[model samples]
Target chain A: MSTPADTMKSGPRGRSRGTRTVIAVLYAVAVPVVLIVAWLIWAGVSPQIFFPSPIAIAEAFVNTWLGPSLTNDVIPSLARLGVAIVLAITIGIAAGTVIGLTPWLRELLEPVLEFFRAIPPPVLIPVFTLLMGITTSMKLAVIVAGAFWPVLLNTIDGVRSTDSVMTETAQSFRLTRAERLRYLVLPSAAPRIMTGVRQTLSIALIMMVISEMFNTSSGLGYRIVYFQRNYLIAEMWSGIVLLGLVGVFLAAVFTFVERRVLRWYHGIKETERA
Target chain B: MTTVATAPERRRRRLSGSTAALGILGLFTIGALLEVLPRIGVLNRRFFPPSSEILTTLIEQLGEGAFWTAVSDTLRGWAIGLTIAMVLGIAVGVIIGSVPFLRDVTSSTIEFLRPIPSVALIPLVVLLYGTKLQSALILIVYAAFWQVLVQVLYGVADVDPVVRDTARSYRFSRWTQLRQVVWPTALPYVMTGFRLAAAVALILQVTAELVIGVPGLGRNLGVAQSSGAVSLTYALVVAVGIIGIAINLFARALERRILNWHPSVRRDVAR
Candidate 1:
């Protein structure tokens, strides 16, 4: 099957370098410029409550988010997100690989996993609060659960789809089950596992915010909701904007990491070395 | 070794048809253990009620008219939000992806908007729509939109340029080229987007209901929990879980049927 990254290579390129740059600059700023203009017009014309202008938002961004709130709220949120992501990826890949190797185990767990997975993580806030209180542990628990399924499921699929030829080669060699899994299975499944991790990143971010928003304090989620509840509209907008920036940064980081990790896969495909 | 019946036993273990029974058995064992655990005081009965009691509550819920109302509301939110997302996602994703200039222009915006966790917008959405159905719609749509949009963008980007040039050489109209050349190549991605958006939409719908106090199963679960109705809360949660399984199975079935021509689907079929 063809991969998306493969399309970039060996495909026709139709633009000059200067034109490409012009297009890039124009395209990059178009939405922001248009949205700012629209915002200015809306704020100028109506002057309604809770509708802060773009300038108000910018100030709100710096004033509210630039100080202790950045350390107190934003740092905690990002920290929780980081922990949840690492936790999910470790458990998901391990469990998924183990189960995928034992196909019957995967099947036996299907109905069970699907049922549990479908229970939206938000619905557990009250339960978690009742049991674990609004502590960091409770938040981490929900975040891990929320971010886990994609990685686990994708890993299972990836491992199961490892080529029969690869499996046979391992069998023909004097490799133990552990060796086969570590050497043959994992390397073959890395691409799909990475895809799953990318999916998990977004879910972890959402879970981080939602878990914080519900009956909690000391995170961007709590801070954002706190601002809104107190009629601090500008501050709330700023928090949301900050949250957006955090997401962009995380995604950019993920793509860069993914490119590095997947470099070998791409390199082999491009050069037909495989 | 299964004594002298090793071959047959091995076949039964390996086959999905027989493994399905094992799956059912596993579920029953887990259910029985859950029923026993709370009663035995292994788990806190106050918070983690027995499975049987939860099942009783589930049965009672099914007989109640309000339960169905909440269920319908949840489904409605999922349907409407997913529809809006698919339409907008496909339209914008295709346009931006096809036009190289537009792709470059909108890349930053899409990257920025796509990752802004939808749950973070609960505050802004609540302010705009105020715990209404529209509030739920706003969250669900925003959350699911990115799933479909990204997939559609990839789909459009993956279109082979040779076919595109052929269409142009034949003087095929833009609309015709899109329908004939682009749609087929992108259909698989669209289906993928649909499945993903469907799941995300449901998750966000429940979330909106739970967090924003909207009218759905999630809201009912929240009420049940706060009122100290432990068994009922578990029951409602189980109901949501069942609904999720149903949706997933339905989506997989649809994908298999729709994408029969695709190699992955064919591979699954052959297996």
Candidate 2:
């Protein structure tokens, strides 16, 4: 079978690198510039409640994140996101390694894992709420359950794909079992493991919002719903915008960390391209 | 679960002959534990019902017209939203991707907005459409749209300029050129995008139904939990899982059938 890199989806960058910089700098402003002008026109034609001018949204954005809403809502929401991702990575990796080592175990759990993976995670919210109550841990559990599969699947693939030659060499040297895993198994798998982490992180974030939406208080999702129900349209928009920004921020951080972790792998790809 | 029959191993373990049996036995053990643990007081039977009870609820649900209606409502959102996304995505992708300036300008904007979770829009959707079917459609369409759009952008970006210029010099009509040149190149990417979006749309449909209290299987799931129908809740969950699996399998089959002429399929055949 071909490696993932062979079939990896790559966005065409451009025709040439030289012409990209100048046109790119100017073109960068095109979307925001058009959107802002359209927003102005929309706000002008509409009432304050429905359209809520860009200025109003900016104010509400600050008010929501920096004002009393910060401690009451934003912090708690971020905290849940952090906790869920951490739990997802920890448990997913550990369980994935065991399955990887035992190929039969991997086959045994395939259907069960696929079932959990496919379930619209929010559907599990009601069951979790019933079993665990509407608390922070309950919220985290939903997020973890939703986030776990990608990491575990990737980790298993990573572990299973560890090079036979490398393992044989380690055996020839009579490396200790723990040493073989630490030095040989993990290093080869690191790139794929990071691939899984990236997928799981985004999933964890999505689940965090979904879990908060049901039977809860003091989180981004709850506050967004709360403001809408209360008819605070601008504030609702602010929360929505904030969530978008937070999503982008988290993704950027994940990409940065992934690039750092897989620098050697990426370098190899870059050299091959060159 | 283990869908394929394994080739016999050259270096076989003592228990290798019984591995398939072992996996089936493991599944039964899990089912038995689900039944026994709650009744034995190891788990709370009130909240966590036995497997048999859940299966019975699932069978009863199949007999109810309301359950079928709910399933149809969920499916309607999935179908309508996926269709809209595909149409809009291909159009926007072609328009934006054909122009270098447009692609460069919109890339950052798309990247910024795409990561925003569809659930985050519950408030915005609720504000606009309430718990109506439109609310579910809006969420489903918006979430799935990005998947198709991005893939199409990549597809268009991949169209070789040399081939494009060669066609231009031959004075090929714009429509013919697009049909012969662009469509074939983009077909695989479009199929990939469609499959991804199909799965995503169903997920968002369920999420919208549950979160917005829309009339669907997810809403039914919510009702079961709220009313303390523990067995029915588990049964509904199992039902949803089955639907998810069915959707994935259906999409995969469709993709494979259509792309049979592609090199990817040829490679698989060679293997």
Candidate 3:
């Protein structure tokens, strides 16, 4: 996790550091541009139907996604992902806390929890569809089911690993269960909880696309498949581009949120390492 | 500190008689509840078959050739995909990590592409290959490759600078330097990546099959759902779950064996 600046400090003894950094930045910028240009050239040369020119994809991207599909497909997908994330965080934290705090409960339910965790959450999509019949609710259920496990499992480990001294100190103060959880246990587990949340974000995004792929009309996943089935090759490629953009956006947001939430944890780790 | 972190988990793994008994009891309680809920009409009978019925259905599936074929199909996709990804990832990661300039050049592009969910490529894959195993392989490889590559890159970056400089001063051949100085440091990270990629490969394998109608347990599960064979779908899910657990156990054991010389594994053994 060392910064590029840190690495550069120990970099080979050579030309000026400033020049090296500028060169590094230029290379970083050049690589992706070069790759895209190469793709464009390849597309223009072969002219395969499946491999549309980058220009054609760009046009299709604006025409297809910047229009009604933005509201119809993209917005709904993001909303479902957003809602499922919230629900997963709440349910996972609640259930995980209960399981984590009680020794007997943790021991008793470990096998059952392991069984469920082992079941790749994707397989539950059909079952959820059958039970709820291809509704938004079912999609939400699919996503939340998939996204919650990391949160739940991490929360259990985090809560269980709370320092024994800290727990005893809280007990000596006669803190009620609610008070202890609020001020002591929860704060101690916040870093791990944030780790879970980070994982949940990606899982939620994946599940959002997945839940839409099955028997649904208006989402990014459906639109992409729809375009493909109709042989709108350019449009399908554009849909994928949009999905990638959304993924990048989610990752950037998660980084921002993690920095804010785990600021103290990072500070502590720095001092401990030093 | 590492031993302290792992001690409780190791103890938990070697479950006491009472804890093991309670765990099994807890599993039965869930099973019994699953059986009772549908029978008592709390859950719909059609969608949520009783546990006994699902167990019987699973047993029936074990005797069927189609079931074994689906299982083998899924495993084939997962294995092939994982092998390709690991090879590509390690090779690319090592080459990139060794050259600071190359690492800097590729970092941004890799970051940009890595987060794009592999499922997003379903449309493109389905278009190019239809429902073939290649479609599933593309998705699985795409998803798993980044996991390994990123970890390996970090591992390479962690190579001790003192040792690297000494190797250079000694005028060791490039291959000798890499083999002697870099590979050992990176092996632990590669193992971490392998474990991660295995799980991801399986998930993507099942996903491609389910969504794209590729031949696998996921395809069977989907077909069962559509056909209203609810118990059969549940059985397929259980079978997939077992496979997942087996893969996980295998990965962990492999990691321990391969990294026995590493401090992380050595510490556990000492404990």
User: Number of the top candidate by TM-score?
Assistant: 3
Residue range with the least summed lDDT across 10 consecutive positions in model 1 chain B: B1-10
Tens-digit per-residue lDDT, B176-242, candidate 3: 9889999999988888899889989999999999999999999999999999998998988999999
Instruction: Calculate the i-RMS of every candidate, to one decimal place.
Output: 5.1, 5.9, 2.8
Global CA lDDT computed for model 2: 0.80
Clashing pairs in 2: none
Model 3 / residue A168 / CA error / Å: 2.3
Q: Is the docking of candidate 1 incorrect, acceptable, medium or high quality?
A: acceptable
Candidate 3: give its CA RMSD in angstroms.
2.8
Model 1 over residues B1-271: C-alpha lDDT tens digits? 0111121222234456767787887799789999999999999998888899999999999999999999999999899999999999999888877776566567788888888888778998889888899988888889888888888887887778677778889999999999998888887888778878888898899989888888999999889877888898889888988888788767766866787787765655464
Poorly placed runs, candidate 1 (over 4 Å): A1-26, A45-48, A176-179, A269-274, B1-15, B260-271
Candidate 3: segments with Cα more than 4 A from true spot: A1-27, A174-176, B1-14
Report clash pairs, candidate 1: A27-B105
* TM-score per candidate: 0.89, 0.89, 0.94
Error of 3 at A44 (Å): 2.6
lDDT at position B234, candidate 3: 90
DockQ of 2: 0.44
Greater TM-score among 2 and 3 belongs to 3
After aligning candidate 2 to the native by TM-score, how far in Å is the CA of B93 from where it should be?
A: 1.9
lDDT of 2 by residue, B177-197 (tens): 888788777877888788779
